[model samples]
Target: MPKSRSRHGAKPEVSPGRATLAAACASLVGIGLARFAYAPLLPAIIGAHWFAPSAAAYLGAANLVGYLAGALLTRPMASRLPAPALLRGFMLLASIAFFACSVPVSLVWFFVWRLLSGIAGGGLMVLAAPTVLPWIPQSRRGVASGVIFAGIGIGIAASGTIVPLLLQQNLALAWDGLGLLALVLTAVAWRGWPARSAPAPTLAARAKIPAHSPLPTTRLRALYVQYALNAAGLVPHMLFLVDYVARGLGQGLDSGAQYWVLFGLGAIIGPVLTGHLADRTGFGPALRLAFFIQAGAVILPALGTGTAGLILSSLVMGAFTPGIVPLVLGRVHELLAHHPSAQKQAWSTATTAFALLQAGGAYGLTYLLTATGGDYRLLFVIGACAFALGLGIDLVVGVSLSRRRFA
Candidate 1:
């Protein structure tokens, strides 16, 4: 939905630092803990023989399905409740979902909770950028978005370290422990959120995209497709790198975990660097550079050997994976600035398209991997190709957009 720019209370008083921190906490609880927690834990769950490989794959995917579905609910929810309330509610649900996963019920129950957690993660992601970005100064938006998004890195790093330690006690402890961590993060973020923020406007509540618009319908359609491809491209590394390192490369679990740490470190640095670059150079150019960089990163591991190659590859993939989010969001705002009425429509439409396709890959790739008998090479190859395709489309569309601006 259109990112909320309006304040609910007279002052909408929350310190920028607090707003950013709340946004980061949302990132932490949402995708960070909700999603990445699964990656590190996946091997452990497997080592313990809790479920068959195929079943585990399905469980991993169930969250993505729920995430896509939950994302669809955000704009609708926004029109009904204030931003802060919606965010708060989603955060609570996220924590509850995490807590539920700790319960060691049947596989069915675990999948259900994973799905619910994914849904919460998706909803929070949809709203967080909208909720926080508008409050910061324009010049600082990229950096602030980076800082906010850095929570993902922190979450990944935390999982890489904490999950392994927790698993030593028991799988139940690991899941339960993460749930508690989510609660702690939520509580820390609770007081920082404003009483209210701009509500998402329903389609009926806002001006419709004009029949004859400044941005062509055809161009927008291409952008949507490109976004979907981009979404699909990221799944391989984020979900499978550790598995690939330990299982595929025969590097062992500790080696895989260490590389995962490298990824987390890269992720922590990626957004701020890319955001600052986007600030100085412009989102489109920075995006192009990132896509190309990510293309190389995704392919590097497939080509290289030993710890050095894996670490370098993970570092690159980690940095570019989540880094792409804030950059694209900034580009969306920049592209639609002249068409004020279309801002919400453009952002919502574009992001939803991305979410659905990514969800498709998340759900589908495991089957592909499982069919290939857990050969992750095929998965990364597919991911790299997808990113390459996305980069080509972006380059073409970028040119088309520049032409239109002058035309």
Candidate 2:
């Protein structure tokens, strides 16, 4: 989706701050509340006997499947429709999905609602940042982007605190509370969407080969695989963290929720801290180091689920969950330096790849969980190995580049 502009190609008069706020709210509702909130609630749904554990895990995967579909479809649909309108519709759709999920008439019914929420989330993810970033001054875009994505953290933190409290009463009430929160966020963002401006570039136009650009095809291929592996590596934590805490380690729901809260706290600062690190160390170094650190963090739980270990694991992994985004984007910018068009195109492809692998990984892990009878440790070990593999790719690519430069 293209940035929202006005007639005559003038920048939209919307306040950059307010527009940023709106986009943030969209992300919070679309991704934060709609997607991540389900993680904390998953154990509750299973505990309440609403669904078998394996069945509920599959339901969680359904949202990811829908997210992949939505990501693939959003740009094409945007071609025929106003992006702002579509964003608003998606926000509303997500809120409605929350309410629909509260009913839980059957497994299929709950799956469809979760899928709809995921679709809404994917639309918001694709459309929200692009729609508002143009309004931000170039010098301040970094801070603005961080603020917008922080909505995901805020939502995560909010769910950690709020869902547990709501679940105290009943599962239905918990879903209703989330729906109400989403509606409030939607209403706050209702007016800040930029009006449609210039027509979006055609797919073919965006995809046209840059005949003589300084593109690093070999390194880019490595980056794409690394990104996919990173997505897969995160599946265990995203879907099972709370459940592992509450059920796997035999901690109660309240204790598990506390760990999630720590995760949220880490998420809230992850982007800002990681972005600052990237600025200081350069994207390549920072990204490669991140892979190594994340591998260790992901594997911590499998090694020992003690209080200290879980805390460290939750905080570090939480930080990297959303934190990896800026690092990847910065790397893309570095690779495609002075090529704005290619940067955008490459980033779009990267996002699609991440979504595709994220969905696939979710289902893969879900099946593994069923096969192992929900062996949380095995999942964490597998996730850590993925990060290790990504790190290995980066190292190999770096060595190749060094050899070619000396030759």
lDDT of each: 0.79, 0.84
Model 1, 209-328: lDDT tens digits are: 454556756656766776778788788888888888878777777777888888888888888888899999998788878778777778766676656777788888888767887887
Q: Total backbone clashes of model 2?
A: 0
List pairs with backbone clashes in candidate 1.
none
Clashing pairs in 2: none
Model 2 agreement with the true structure over 1-407: per-residue lDDT tens digits: 44444322455756667788999899789877898899899989998999998889899988888887777788888889997899999999999999999998999999999999989988888778777765665445555666777788888899999999999899999999999999999999998877854344445555663657777878877888898899899888888999998998888899889998888888778776777777777789988988999999999899985889999988988888878877887788678754555665676677678889999999998888888876889999999999999999999888989999999
Compute the lDDT for candidate 1. Answer: 0.79
As a TM-score, model 2 comes out at: 0.91
